[model samples]
Target: MLLKLDLTDSRPLHEQVAGAIRRAIAEGECAPGDRLPPARELSRALGVNANTVLRGLRALRDEGVLEFRRGRGVTVLAGADQRARLVDQAGALLAEATRLGYSRADLVELIRRLP
Candidate 1:
């Protein structure tokens, strides 16, 4: 996978890593059931600490975009592209809402009130 990091980005390294992977998945750079490069390999390529890569991968797994299997390694989950896009959109919405002085509960309530 080709993971790109914007050195100028102010977000945490882990978040940038996750965003790169998420974009790759959304762009069809990888598909469902496709195994990801090992975290160490990714760290080496991205020039970040292995733990940082793992943290990003863990975040993806938590977002349901990737799955971790013993010995099988990390693989993209089915429907990951769509899910990743939705997750990204939700994140953007949350950030915007926060910037507007709204809390998480306010965002949730706003979403709930949507038709």
Candidate 2:
């Protein structure tokens, strides 16, 4: 769910963080059974309060998009296969990049994947 921030955007940092996490979940960038960073950590990273992270998480949980356990923390609801799901979802990204004249190397650099 975590991604780079858009320094130029007018959106609030917390909203951006929440949106990124939401998109990741929707697109399978974060898979079922995946665990999110703790609220304090995310807040520190995003330069926001822990309560902001908590609100975002609670909103997602209320939407049935994530499960938050009191002590164990937050985890994606496990069922979908991470690899296959991401592969399918990434097809659109690949095509869009091609349409925009981006090479695989350029995409790799821009995305800068964790692994």
Candidate 3:
């Protein structure tokens, strides 16, 4: 999977990395049981610290989206279809919000207000 990170963005590198992986999984770029690149390799590719990549991987692991094994590397979990649906819905929401002149933060705030 290819991940793009914007250093100028306010979010931390770890969070951005995690988010990128999440989106990739959610968009069906990765299916369940697929193993991700080793943390050190991913870190090298992204030009970030290995620990940063590990932190992102661990965050996904904590969310049950990935499994870390001693020598098998990190594996994608099941429930990809559900995640894809969610990502599609989120995209639709964002598109509509933009059409309505709302920024991403505005859409998030509006969603937060929903009961």
Candidate 4:
């Protein structure tokens, strides 16, 4: 998997790691049932701590984009491509709303008001 972190990005390292993996999934770098490189391997490649990589992986798993299996490693989940895309879009929306001085609750309200 090709994971790229923007050194200029101000987000937390773990978030950057997660974003990179999310992008990889959205771009088809890996597919459902595909095993991911170990956290240590990813940390070495990204020059971050292994814990940071694991945290990122956990975040992806929480978002339903990846799955963790005992002795089987991490695998991309089915429909991950679409899930990743929605995550990207939601992140963009949140960023825009924050920039516009709207709180997350306000964003939620806006969505609720939508048809």
Best by TM-score: 4
**Reference-based lDDT, each prediction:** 0.95, 0.71, 0.84, 0.96
TM-score of 2: 0.57
Candidate 4, residues 2-111, lDDT tens digits: the string is 88898899999999999999999999999988999999999999999999999999999999999999999999999999999999999999999999999999999999
Q: Which pairs clash inside model 1?
A: none
Instruction: List, residue by residue over 68-97, the lDDT tens digit for candidate 3.
Output: 888898999888546645755676789789
- Write candidate 1's Cα lDDT for 22-111 as tens digits: 989989999999999999999999999999999999999999999999999999999999998888888899999999999999999998
Residue 105, model 2, lDDT: 84
Task: Sort the candidates on TM-score, descending order.
Answer: 4, 1, 3, 2
1 against 4, candidate with superior TM-score: 4
Residue 14 of model 3, lDDT score: 93
Candidate achieving higher lDDT, 1 or 3: 1
Off by over 4 Å in 1: none
Candidate rank order under lDDT:
4, 1, 3, 2
Q: 114, model 3: CA deviation in Å? A: 7.5
Candidate 4: residue 9 Cα off by (Å): 0.9
